[model samples]
Target: MQLFAYLESFPILHIFELLELTLAIMIKRLLFEEAEITAREFKIVAITGPRQSGKTTLCKHVFKNKHYVSFEDLDILEEADSSPRSFINKYKDGAVFDEIQRVPGLFNYLQTHVDKVGKNNQYVISGSNNFLLQQNISQSLAGRAAYIELLPLSLLELQEHWGNTKNPVFFMMNGFYPSIIAKQSSAERWLPNYLKTYIERDVRMIRNIENLNLFSKFVKLAAARSGQILNVNNLANETGVDNKTISAWISVLESSYIVYRLQPYYNSFNKRVIKSPKLYFYDVGLLCNILGLNSERAIKQSNMYGAIFENLVISEIKKNRFNKSQYGEMYFLRDSTGNEVDLVLEKDGNLIPVEIKSSAKYRSSDLKNLKWFQRLYRIKGGMLINQSTENQELEDGIMNIGWAEVANV
Candidate 1:
């Protein structure tokens, strides 16, 4: 039951060596380029993502000259709430407003200041709750604000230490959170506390759920269903809650960036194609903890290993896509008769199919759905992602790429 003790059994990562390798992450993020461009062009640039994904750090790094004020401080939040105009005037030169969603009414004041000044890069805002942040932005600063989504570290972002050779399972268990990867922090020690805080603070802020214990149960149950088609009715039954409550809780999780729903790609490919979206956690290490897979051996022996592996590959690819400012372009293909491709990426006028498998042994049969889908669509190239270290080209245009190289694809 002791999560930290169980995690300590994994292969030790030398702290000194890891610090040397992870220096690149501390120095730069893939989103820095996009954030910089947005800040230059837009009067207000908003960086939003799950908490501790490094929004504050990235904002400070990108806008070093700007004064930073956190609204998480109760006194500061009260001041902004009571005297929005004066608060805005106090930071008239410009400031990074961290956790801006806490003072929703302050956005109108921000709008006024930015308009009168008529200068770009005058204000930068960030928050963890996407729904509240975007709602405030749409109501007040729609055209003036440009948004950037920052997920956990992508595989490509951490390529210096973990790109080609490390086992995908290791990263899956350790996770890709900035502190965990950049500081060699213990996932076991950190994630439990993070989850508790999210349930206590974010869930309360988003919506009033009378029972925190029930909500916690719903989240763990949801984690168990990761990488599978979401069946709300069944989940509601299992959680002893109505479908409507289950649906609302899911929205809270999605808005807070705890989990994401990967929609099913539908086309003329089949009329009976499954339309429900599949669920996935934004960070695999958190998913592992929720499922009580504290040790590496437990992770490998558990039946969910394959699903966890699939989640890692898909989430990394998503981070890569979002880092480039692309949104709503990823999906999975599954039909009534057991035809499924792990991931389907919609590119510029083309559908790039990707298959994920956890086994290292190359099985010709594992490529069945990928091959079938490509031929049916008359697509020329595809990728078979697996646990292999050596990237190789197979018959046709499909390539077997290691999981660590997922973000690159």
Candidate 2:
């Protein structure tokens, strides 16, 4: 087939080719909320997230009328590197450069160019990995840019796309990747593809690991230990990977927004406290898949039930804090002496302690650690989250609510 004939054969494909950014997603309303914040006063809006999380699509949608280009294309990357000023001149004005970190030096050029040559919304840059992109942009576009992160689509965002559902089981199994939800496919099919592609793309782009097969196994091992107090040495010993490699790989995961670490609260107390951070998979569905739990039935019968509950409670609360106008912080209470609470929430100078139980039957025993935390923090009230019938405030004055209300908790 001739070149023009091949192009003519698929006219529709060329007619409207999307850049695979935010607009290709159904969570536009949620992303719009994020865009509104960035568009406020900052000269540069750098939207960063893991690969395949829709950074490019959203930016194009927001900057549809502006000059749009992607550094993912090698030619443009070379053009920006060889002649940045010419690249700027080429794009008349207000330009959106997708995956701009492909050429870090270009940010230095934009810092001055956007000011002298263009208007408020003149330039937008996107990057997949912050490990390399952070230092580049900081040295160049530090104060001039307004930055926001785009993690895997949130539950509320997914709710906007799929409407509402009563399936906590669905989230635990499928996780909330945008492509998986927007297209609305079965968890069994998409989760495997998601893992294979995500590992192949992100792991190679950020670092040069000699053994990718080992690194892949490491991801699965890390998933099994989600929502637990992580001991780096222990993990390294189990995976047969050195402690340094484990630490570096975990940092890669953080920059990619695949997992998060919550630090323990430190206070002035005689009882020694464990200062180590706890680990959590940002997407519970991905975590479950990594653990090899196939379905809702598998999850319900697993020994990881307590840990899953912990992940649910912590993630839901963290999501709530981020979604609101005010920012709220999450903490866990644990001491060297061995007294611990499953989750701790700190906001507006107050400490709220919560304990999670796997059972539906209620008892004061469930609130033991919360009661202990209350004495130290003067907590407004303690909470015991359980899987049960109704939400109640116990006679001891602690709020005990069913864990099923995690969405509202």
Candidate 3:
């Protein structure tokens, strides 16, 4: 297949390219280490989320005491692929298997080992591609696996290491992918190369993309459409590919952690549930690059301000979800009608509904959906997050908070 067709050619490399895999990953230490404790409690820790979202880094970071073996290391994968049990036995007491999806059969063997040992965090298993990884894990590990989402650096984690800045707008404009935060000499070349390399490696790894050009076009089109309700047919028409391929390509981007789909949330007494999902890029800077967004001035003047704000909102929710140290447990809410809240935090079935707005000025109308949905679902309460200067209690029973405040809390 001509799947490699989509990888744009570039003749340069950044210094960070050589250093990314072993740069001492400052954010790893700053990230929620206490969060990994939950996975340790489970029989097998299944770390997932988008590519370069740092799944491998987190595994390496947490399993400092455990021997490390990467399937991408060729020899290790050959061992696991040829002799799953023996491959595992070599690790003996235990080890970290990075990108275990490359050797799916080993999971069952690992599960057996954990069962025999009777639990105590026997294995630290992580995969960048979740769609197939989850399927194999469910088939092999199931209840034995504890899955955690390792997304791109969260705003809160960034602030911790990078230090807090006065510019909320700047952060919102660039967003949080670790490489961008590294302050490399040339994010210009770095960003595009990163996207291209990711497209070639992770995107092609999932499915054989015969029409790489179409796939590349799909990325550009998707970037331009960020923050809008995703229309598969429209995307299909634009890309000259079937909706199935478009959908699959989008899934590839999502699985690679390049973009995320924000499923809408709401229930006007079962009146306004939207079926179509809204898509957002994992990082604003990447989206901006694909869409040709060059300057902070340009992002500010662009019409996507509201959508970018909403993207920031969801990204923060994802960060905190991981921040809590819980594994594989974050989702949005919506029904059949159009009444919608931006995000939903569903834990233990409590249904914490959240809303996000870009304007510092928040109004009662902003939280109407949340209030209505909360009353109907009997949720804990509706949380209204925005660019407000300070966290305050609104008279109308809503919690008005700055985006940053809500992210850490």
Model 1, range 160-208, lDDT digits (tens) per residue?
4553446777876788887787655698888888999999999999999
lDDT of each: 0.87, 0.74, 0.72
Clashes of 1: 0
Order the candidates by lDDT, highest first — what do you get? 1, 2, 3
Top-lDDT structure, candidate number = 1
Local accuracy of candidate 2 as per-residue lDDT tens digits, 1-409: 6855755765563423442343364366355566756765677787777766666667767777777788877888898899987887787466777877678777766777777754566677788877667777778877777776666666555555667544566678877666566554577787777778767877787787778789888898898888878899988998898999899999988877778899888877634878889999877877888888878899999999779867866776666555453466788888877789888877677777888887888876787788788777665586788777689888557888876565565
| TM-score of each candidate structure, all chains considered together | 0.92, 0.88, 0.81
Residue range 1-409, candidate 3, lDDT tens digits = 3533422242234233434544436655344365367655787777787666666666666677888788888877787899987877888787787888988777778878888889577787878888878889888888887777777777776666667644556765455666666655344565777778877777777888877777889999998788778999999998898988888888888877788887655445655566678788877767777777667787788798777777767766676766666444444565555566777776665666677888888887887788777677765566788888788877446688887786564
Judging by TM-score, tell me the better candidate of 1 and 3: 1
Selected candidate, larger TM-score, 1 vs 2: 1
Native-vs-model 2 lDDT?
0.74
Point to the candidate with the largest TM-score. Answer: 1
